[model samples]
Target: NQTKMFDEKKLDINDEKYSSFGAVLTDDNNFYFTSARNTARKTYGANEQPYLDMYMATYNADGSFSEPTPISDINTKWHDGPAAVTADGNTMYFSGESFKESKQFERDKDNNLKLGQIYLFKATKTDGKWGNIQPLPLNDKTYSTGNPAISADGKTLYFVSNRPGGQGGNDIWKVEVKGNNTYGEPQNLGDKVNTPGNDNFPYLTTEGKLYFSSDGRKGFGALDIFVIDLAKGTEAKNVGLPVNSGQDDFAFSFNDSKEIGFFSSNRTGVDQLYSATPICGVEAIVMVRDANTGKPLASAKVAILDERNNVIETRTADTNGKVTYSVDCDRAYTIQASMSGYENNSFPIAKTHGGEVNVMADLRPIVEIVKEIEVVLNDIFFEFDKSNITKEAAFELDKLVEAMNNNPEMVIMVKAHTDNRGSAQYNMNLSNKRAKATVQYVISKGIA
Candidate 1:
């Protein structure tokens, strides 16, 4: 199972003042982080030294990140840092301090910050552009919410808060999406995962593994990244070494395979980004086509069946008349291709390791037309009342010759027709002359 690969790089922040944290990868391989480089005055000012802000940077396919650019709309003069991106790379959820000056650190009876709230903003792609932001309903003024973590499906959100009713100082809470742009009430993750100490910065991998930073257990530093199998138990274990050094290691996200992840660390004397690569299995690709013409046919469907004929992966061909899919090559599969007007085809494929095999199966159309039949012109017409053959008459006669040559055994009687506008004897004479001319043209072309 050690087939997956991962590589890490330390993202460079060209500016000397700001530091990077909470690095997440997008489907396009771009990375997003938070920083506090040049925030001094705006809608509100920060009481702390570093007024943080979120930023985005693109990562080239060669595993390098571009210079960071501040997401100014979401960033403000107040503290804002550590963002979590959805797997699709469209939505963003992050933690930030209130940007309003009139309400600075106002606390309720429970001493929770009334203005600080965990905010969720959606970024949609319209005409290949992204810039719209909307707030989520789970944010409340009674408590301070930050350190957001979203599930791979974008249906569940997890964050840390110091509101009321928690196992410790900052307990992890979850909000499930109820419908379009709506979410249910926030619920605590319960004692199985939370401790009396602070538990925050939750990161969920595609495989359902949970990674977060906590100081509950004896660790190397103040906050250490821990992994917990939520399905089994929440007893967290440190993701040792290069990933977690003696300092704070939080804000981690993984690809679908759960083998590789990106996390931030200050062990290098600066809060930088690093990646962990684990062995991941490769997915398979398959295609189908028309055997005779080599032309792609749309609406064709393909299915992969196991030894017991149980369907495994089924997909329909896209508009390009091809279907591409990825499947773990763990077992032998019987590939089947079928369409409504074509005969079905099937072949067996043996599983192999880490290689792309093009299994293209061509299907034959069931009701096909043969190309051996010859069709001939049965009649030729005379112009008006004249008996002379016209140029157009030669054109029709030449086609008859071509048909006869295409089918050697074909024979035809060329008949000439005349409109009944003339006298019977004159009409008969004109028809006779036209038929003779047609026969002469056919014979000239070497057709019998």
Candidate 2:
């Protein structure tokens, strides 16, 4: 469940401060993200970073990008940017604040605290430049509304705000975009999607799935990306792993097909934009257990071998006797498992495009074969005249080794029958050498 389900690529547009992430794959090929790398701008007291400015660059298909340029027309000295462009790319809705009435900083008026609130502004691109910028009616003096996301059809606008009648904190609200650039009343998405915690950055896909960021739900960490199907009217589900982590992850945007996408996260401690591609690789999970009892064998050794039988990695299984590996797409693998007091086993994993491959290893327990303290086998007569332990004698020694393994406290004294093939002194020496050889053979098979 914690696997990286997506083939994610970090964007090069990231600065050490904040490279930003919002709308992606605009029609003009223009990229947008927030950056606070400009030391020239005064630092905001909130996060202690420089004030954010709308940065732009030319996006390439190979995940390469041109140098970022600040959108001066929409970027005020205050924090700006994180803009959403319509399907045509002619219209843009961005987050910024007006500097009118000495409101850049220090709202001195005791009752005038609205100067610092963020506003959603709409701008039109003409002759390759953004102008005719104006704030949307959703902005108010008492509350903040910004981070706008326009639906693909341009009939609905989704954004974050702390206005009245909200679920709490920052909630995602939508308004109907009527004819003539007019908007209907803003409506909260309700508790299904909105919580009493901060929820922001909504990107609605043409397929009716709304992807947004929130700290309100259960996730790996601070903020995670979630998706709720607006058509199905279900609660949001956490889009886990690679896309989310033990840090703030938000601002998810996917193309029309929801294949290629972009999202921002502070998993590295510095916020950056990451390009997400669906992982077509296969996930192989192996579980090892006892063959006879059918119970899990903990701490069993599992080795993953490639198609050529070359060992990739030898890892120990978890408490549940499970070990997982990220295998390549369309590549076959073999999972070999081994444990003490059990015979080793191996299983096969077939090639797959993008899914899980579960394999189970059932190992046979080493049964006790040695019964009596003294035993003479049928085809096993030791050559007491020589020092070399015969193959027949070694075979019986394995049974003794298995017996010692089963009863750790059992100790055996070896005795050898001698032949009068030489002098009495020579026969006595042969008997001692044969006894030593028998004990050595059993000790070699892991018997103490």
Candidate 3:
């Protein structure tokens, strides 16, 4: 659908005051966005400047929005606004300035309030109202973690964080939702998606593509919405034109079907919402299989290489021995597929008109005819002092597994060895553990 272009238009929902750039369309047909219009302060003082707050407006059937209503329950007097809601509409995750009521604002030497780093917060809908606000486990007081974007199934949450150990200023991070509010450690999105500049407002589409605005990557404006196909593992590319402009453009969100979407932009000098439509793209499907037997190779490691032969992305073939990635037209690519006991294979894909591109990678089996005391197999390597089977070791073990599968009557012994660095007993024990782990890994791969 990359051939179509979008005609962008600013929504009538703009005001002279500051308006935050995030907006999400919920399943219940209500539009939710961030705005600083509701900053009336009572806790601090009457003259204190009001901060951003989450506002909801009803989406009428005639394409106009009703009067906006600020949700005071979730909004604090400090900073709170736009949020991402789950498909079931039961939970909401949003960004807000860190606060604990007592220590809400920390002032500087001049007694001026120092803005707190934004943190992610969660709230659940009960009886048609959102309450039970809880901070995410990954939220740090020293760093900021806001701009929440939840996956469709609600298992992963992606957000922008200025946390330590980032590629640059405010890199994007994702954490696994381990059910019942527990979360795993946050993982940086890496240098591919992150840049030396600020990258915020991550929006994950239903199709596994991440769309976020970044001033770091090449773009037409200050902050352009660039989409990276998570499944394809390609570099992010700007969405271009009407959706992007010379001003800051970000906070992109799409509907369930992806037919139409909304994004916030400051092209009009004031932050306002705009709608976008998908224009061009193609689904590139790659299939891996055995060259001789024509059997689909499941679990095959597929690496997508660009013109410079740099592996931009890697994917594991599914049970059907197939993986699909979205790509633009007029770009060439190569795919390398490798499995245990097979010669690595590469399939070259040439650029063409926009559409689906099917690639077949046929890997040849590496047969080692042995006449020695034991049928020799390839070597298995492990990390330093670790007994876990690495991906490389697994590939070697696959060769052994395939040999055993081919000759059902053959049984081989595992001769474990260790160097002289460790204590004799300790080294022996570690080597034995490694041997046992290798056997278990083979069994786990269905090689009895």
On TM-score, the candidate that comes out on top is 3
lDDT of 3: 0.79
Lowest-lDDT window of 10 residues in candidate 3?
41-50
Over the stretch 299-391, how does candidate 3's per-residue lDDT look in tens digits?
A: 999988777667778999999899787766678888878787676656888986555688988877756533355655556677767788886
10 residues in a row with least lDDT, candidate 1: 369-378
Candidate 1: residue pairs that collide: 3-280, 4-278, 4-279, 4-280, 6-277
Candidate 3 stretches with Cα past 4 Å from truth are 1-5, 39-50, 60-62, 100-107, 110-115, 280-448
TM-score of 3: 0.61
User: Which lDDT value does model 1 have at 169?
Assistant: 77
lDDT of 1 at 292: 91
**On a 0 to 1 TM-score scale, where does candidate 1 land against the true structure?**
0.54
lDDT of each: 0.67, 0.79, 0.79
lDDT of 2 by residue, 1-448 (tens): 5556566777767775654656466756777777887778998877888888888888776668889888887777777878888888888888887553234334648887545677888899899899988778777756788998888888899989999999999999999988455799999999988899999999987778899998989988799899898886866888788788899989988775436788988877788889888767787878898987889999989988888767899999899999888888888888878777765656888878765677889876755233456432333466435778764456445545655677787778877767667888888887888788888888788887
Candidate 3: Cα lDDT at 143? 78
- Rank order (by lDDT, best first): 3, 2, 1
- Rank by TM-score, descending? 3, 2, 1
lDDT of 1 by residue, 1-448 (tens): 2223334555554344445678777777667777656545432344333566777888676666787777766665556667777777766776665444335345666865454554445445555455565555655566667788888889998888877889887888888866567888889988766789988889887667788888786667877777787765646777665566688777777765424578777776656666776433334455677889877767788877777667777788876667654556466677777665565667677776533456776766644321334343424556676767564455445455545564567666656778878789988888888778777777888876
Candidate 3, residue 415: the lDDT equals 61
